[model samples]
Target: MTKEEAKKKWDLTRKMLEITDDEYNGVTQEDANLRFVKMKLQIAVYYMQLLDEHDSEYQVPWNKEQFKWALRKPVGDKKKQQAKEWCHQCRLMRDKTCTNWNYEEVKTA
Candidate 1:
């Protein structure tokens, strides 16, 4: 897929998942817990795209850092809670970006 197609797919996935700005920002920035979720989501998207390709042995474009993140799943209640929060934040961010990429509009008062 082209770059625009991939971006559109990412945006559409975020919207369909109802991701909010807080969640998106959490992973995009310095939130370690949420970053895991972001990586997982991106990884999943990559795999999905791979499945759609006719070449089954095609190599995915993910780097080392992404694989490292995707390899570690959240364990225990506390970590799970953090992961849940991250999912929520990500969903919110996705939703916000689906429309306009406005910072102020995404901020909740």
Candidate 2:
């Protein structure tokens, strides 16, 4: 089945299972499997959020110079290393010096 169809099926199955103490006693194997899938999905979503937050922390402002640098073809290893260092420095400076980094500007740009 397609991803959307599987998602809809999972949602429907989860909704059908009532969350109550009494329902725990007679849990069928199918119910257990569905619960396991639901738990895995929850964990996967949590990890994805964590990864997104981690990536955002490393985000640097993209000005004209940076944009131009990014568009350059056949960048040398030295240039790539320099760029990585510059990005790292930017993140450090942002954390230490800039107490209020303009997130709205970053988001808009």
Local accuracy by lDDT, each model? 0.44, 0.41
TM-score of every candidate relative to the true structure: 0.30, 0.29
Find the candidate with the highest TM-score and give its number.
1
Candidate 2: residue pairs that collide = none
- Residues 12-80, model 1: lDDT tens digits: 544433434775566533445445455555545544433332122233344546434433544234544
Off by over 4 Å in 2: 1-26, 56-109
Candidate 1, residue 34: how far the Cα is off, in Å? 1.3
lDDT of prediction 2: 0.41
- The residue-by-residue lDDT of candidate 2 on 1-109, one tens digit each, is 3334435534643343333454344367544443343343343333223323333333333444753453244344444554445445554544553344366533432
